[model samples]
Target chain A: MKEHLFEYLLRLGDDSLILGHRVSEWCGHGPILEEDIALTNISLDLIGQATSLLKYAGEVEGKGRDEDQLAFLRLEHDYKNCLLVEQLNGDFGMTIMRQFLFDAYRLPLFEALIHSSDSQLAAIAEKSLKETKYHYRHSAEWVIRLGDGTEESHERIQKAVNSLFKYHVDLFFTNHVDDALLKEGIVPEMKAIHNKWMESVKNVFSEATLEIPSNNWEQSGGRLGRHSEHLGLLLAEMQYMQRAYPNMEW
Target chain B: MSKNDWPLWEVFIRSKQGLNHKHVGSLRAADAEMAIENARDVYTRRSEGISIWVIESNNVYASDPSDMDSLFEPSQTKVYRHPTFYVVPDGISHM
Candidate 1:
């Protein structure tokens, strides 16, 4: 049970940590100043969430691994994030699309997790849900604006939507670890969360005039640590400082 | 490159429930919603406010600096309008 819980926590923690890292890459690169600050603020919130989750995971594992160690010392294959989060940020349209999809999934997941039998998970979810609500609003608004804006914006974001739709399925990926936790009432039912996610996606996409792809193919495996080529490059940069200067403290 | 220049807005924040919204700073945004959202990101990252209000910079009307005396010189001499003569009871606080 502890092992399964630890793995589940890693799945949650790694997703936030990696996506936070990805969003932080937009620190100085936002198309507008206000959006730059907004994206960076969201990145900070996600990293803050990652800190709490990874710290709790470390405690559950009973390994002296602190949040820093869990975050900085892990190899690419050890990460248990969804494949959607680890994908490269192609453009503003692509980035916003990625964020919108993830926020749709995460908001409901956190909302359901707030009722978990695990008190620690419930507490973290309660705190994270507030931030996720704001993130969802921001990303959803951007999606609607960009998707329905000028002809160029509409075209670019539509292309992004079609390209990124396949990764959405992996968010609800389940395995034996999840099954055990689900039976124990430690995690929410993925099917219910998926339904809520679909409703939200449909509502927002309808507003944005963006079409969901008819194809249902899904590219997954990040949760099982089978990541794409991108994760290696992301980890190389993320782990560079820690790898080069072992035990160095700021 | 300069095609996307959004309108400027002034941000006002009320730090607590009873406090009045005070102007904090200005930022550029495409609309009122974006202005408020930008204000939230730019001004309230430190948890500095409980509420935010944003107004377009162009919508605000300010008195002319050149007409300072014409607009305000008469008020300086109005000692009767001052509240210094009123004495508060001991129990009354924050008046």
Candidate 2:
């Protein structure tokens, strides 16, 4: 039970950590100065959430590992995040689409997790839910603006939606670990969350004048330890400082 | 890409619940909603405010610098309008 719980916690923690890293890539590179600052602020919120979650996961594992160790020392394949987060930040439109999809899923996931049988998980979810609400609004508003904006923005964002939509399924993937947690009431049912997520995506896409891709195929496996090539490159950059100087502290 | 510049907005922040909103700075945004969100990210990252108000910069009316003396010179001579004539009691430190 503890092991399954640990894996589940890692899945949650890694999602925030990796997505935080991806969003931080836009720190100085956003399309505009205001957006640059906004994306960076969102990145800070995600990394902060990751720190809290990974720290708690360490406590549950009863290992000597701490947040920094867990974050920086893990192998590329050791991460348990959904593949959606690891997707590259292609362009401003693509980045917004990626963030919107993740935020839509995360908002409800956190809302449900706030009632977890595990008190610590519930507390973390409560704190994170407030931040996720704002994130969802910001990203969703951008999606609407760009998708319904000029011809070029509409075309570019539509392409982004089609390319990124396939990764959304990975977020709700369930296996033995999720089954155990569900049986014990540590988490909510994925089916309900999935339905809610689909409704959100459909409503927003309708407003944005975008269409969901007809293809039902999905690319997954990050939760099972198989990742795309992007994760390797991302880790190399993220872990550089810690890897160079073991146990170094500012 | 749209060639037009995004509109500029002036940001005002209320540092605490009871405090008045004070002008902080300005930034460019596509609309009022984006302006508020941008103000939040740019100004309130340090937990500096409890509320934010953003107004389009173009909507603000400012007095010209050339009219500074004409606009303010009358107030300088109106000492009666000042409350300096009153003396506070020793027990009332704030007054």
Q: Pick the DockQ winner.
A: 1
lDDT digits (tens) for residues B1-95 of candidate 1: 25356788999999999999999999988789878888999899999999999988899999999999999999999998989888899999999
RMSD vs true structure, all candidates: 2.0, 1.5
Off by over 4 Å in 1: B1-4, B84-95
TM-scores of the candidates are 0.94, 0.96
Candidate 1: C-alpha lDDT: 0.93
lDDT of 2 by residue, A1-250 (tens): 9888989999999999999999999988988888898999899899999999999999889888899999999999899999989999999999999999999999999999999999999999999999999999999999999998889999999999999988887899899999999999999999999999999999999999999998887988889989989999999999999999988998
Tens digit of per-residue lDDT, candidate 2, span B1-95: 24376888999999988889999999988999999999999999899999999999999999999999999998999998989998787888766
Q: Which ten residues in a row have the lowest lDDT in candidate 1 chain B?
A: B1-10
lDDT accuracy of residue A150 in candidate 1: 86
User: Against the true structure, whose TM-score is highest?
Assistant: 2
CAPRI quality band, candidate 2? medium
